[model samples]
Target: MNRIQQKKDYLKQSLSLLRDKFSNIPADKSVIHKVASPLRLEHAKGIVADAILKIMNDHNLQMLALLVNSCRSEVVKILNEYSEKYFKELKWAVIDEFGSVILKLNTNIATHNYLLPPLLDDLEESSESSDFYAKSTNYFSAINQNLLKIVIYHWRLFKNATEQGYLSASELILKSNVSQASVSNFIRYSLEKNYLLKHKIHNLYKFNNNCLEDLLEDWSFYYKNNYGKAIRFISYDTTYSIDTLLLKVKVLRDHNIRIAIGGFLALELQKLNYVSDIPDIRIYTDNIKYTKDELDLIEYQSQDDVTGRKIIELVSPKAEASIFSHIMNKDIPICDIIQCYLDVRHKASRGMEQADFIKKSVLL
Candidate 1:
């Protein structure tokens, strides 16, 4: 029922599934690694897919192993596709019996020199190499919270700038609330990654105008992996509709509850509508549990229990700073263009089309 309990339940279920499948694997051949999903919900799929992709590229890791839980088929497929397309020499073993992975390195195929020291230690300590099941704990280890905030600050400046206005490094550090050392480090990293170009004008070090699209995506991905945990529920009442949900949300807002609309419903309210059916409503707040109590929402025992029912998702943005920048629409607060776009970009329901429209019509 609570966040910690839900996580414990998920880990227990996951480990039980893994043990049954790997029981026959030679003790010498199999290793078990314990991992926690970034999101609290078990049915919240693809939480680790992006992490896995980043690890493989960052560490030049090879020989991926997969344990295919019935619920994780989509994530497994994505890992398989990415590995095949990028690393032709990489190996994949999808164990159907165990819904987990064991990373058994084949020294003959994998190069010893490519194995990074820190990663090797983590693997050795865990005695597991199943990249699919293991948490990519260090995926965003190098990125700082201030770095992301600085990027977002620049993005806001770019959006409002009437002309090519460049800020000096010192000014950037002062306005973005970051340390001088962090700004220096960010300048170095951005230049190296080709995200920004530096120019010297009138003895001032200024950065060239670089589009924040890629940087924003990176920020969103990092935020999702680290902070985007949500408490979701489905209504047992079949008569409750999207319109009804909006009315209730408006009531919560009237009571001074700091709630903002997000996801599909937010997009529709912002007039960037592309999807025909509103599958669910996403609400962003600082304290979801408190808000849920205010809204009198019930937590469903299982997703299967309420098939074809209206769902409500309550997410608390745990980022150091607020990314929503929400606008009040007809007494209802809704997330900004960037937040709405990022929220629905990966959804199954025409999410790409909606995101494209926002880019062309608003962001571009």
Candidate 2:
């Protein structure tokens, strides 16, 4: 198909998908009708905006600028009779295509609605500490330590059951192993939190929205500001070998954070392809020798050099040395490392020791 026909087809598909997803809402009919017809005027504006985006991507910026100007002239003509609110809403669709285009035109665009006064008040009262681990622990503890585990388990079960087609209340109870009352409570909670939906016909539960994406985005922002510039204290061992460490490294990089690998894995990192892609990687191995080719095998890259910092290696005498001390000496924060260590220690002491320790810790 030609470019113009392709653009029209895409818009038709998008409108159809949106209507199908929102079939439950009564207002969706009006929304769908608006996209289907040019009576709203904004419908044509959306088409023009989409076409401009295609041209922008296919051609040079200079050519795109001219095309945008031509489209803007036509858009202004169509929007002349529309009110500011209607125009503003139409501008949102335009901004979605080319953010710079909207900004260049100097349109008064408000992307997100402002938070309610109560929410703003709560946020203001919350402490503004750069220590993410401490803040996360405090937030999770306030809710209850086991809440995350329960939520994650339910979330996984909901996803798995949905993929398999449908699930019954009995199936949910069996998979989660929670009391009937608790299951009902979690279902209500998930609905309120916009995490899960109920399929009425199938009588099954499924993820309502992309909660995982939001969770990962939240963590990414938290880690970037808190630990991106710091040297990480990794407890590497035979169990946590180079392969396992590489997975963690990829996760950190995916979140656009830079970390210097420290501990036993540092030697193993130097023996792999850590340098060719992740040249900023600094290995803190105790006199381990590696060839340049081995260093060249590491495959990782920073999203941007703006947040990148040079890596420094600190040699330690023991294999399992106090890596935290070295990190502290370097003036890098170690709250995340400390919290991780404590978490591991708690998990290891899981029987009566855990119960006794928890009681003592809480009592104190």
Number of the predicted model whose TM-score against the real structure is largest:
1
* Residue 266 lDDT, candidate 2, scale 0-100: 37
TM-score of 2: 0.27
**Candidates' RMSD to native:** 13.7, 20.1
lDDT of 1 by residue, 119-187 (tens): 112232333433322333232333344444444446555745633344567876776565787666666
Q: How does candidate 2 score on lDDT? A: 0.32
- Local distance difference test values of all predictions, in order: 0.52, 0.32
lDDT of 2 by residue, 1-364 (tens): 4433333334333433433433422231222211212223366667545534543454322111111201332333444334243333232221111111211222453322111111011222324322321232232231221232334434544544544544455676665454676456555544543445677877776653344333322222332233323232223222434454456444443443333344223322323221223322334333222211222222224434223332222222221222222232222222122222222222222322432342233211
**TM-score of every candidate:** 0.51, 0.27
Residue 10's lDDT within candidate 1 is 45
For model 2, name the residue pairs that clash: 273-297, 273-298, 274-298
Q: What clash count does candidate 2 reach?
A: 3
Model 1: how far residue 87 lies from native, Å: 22
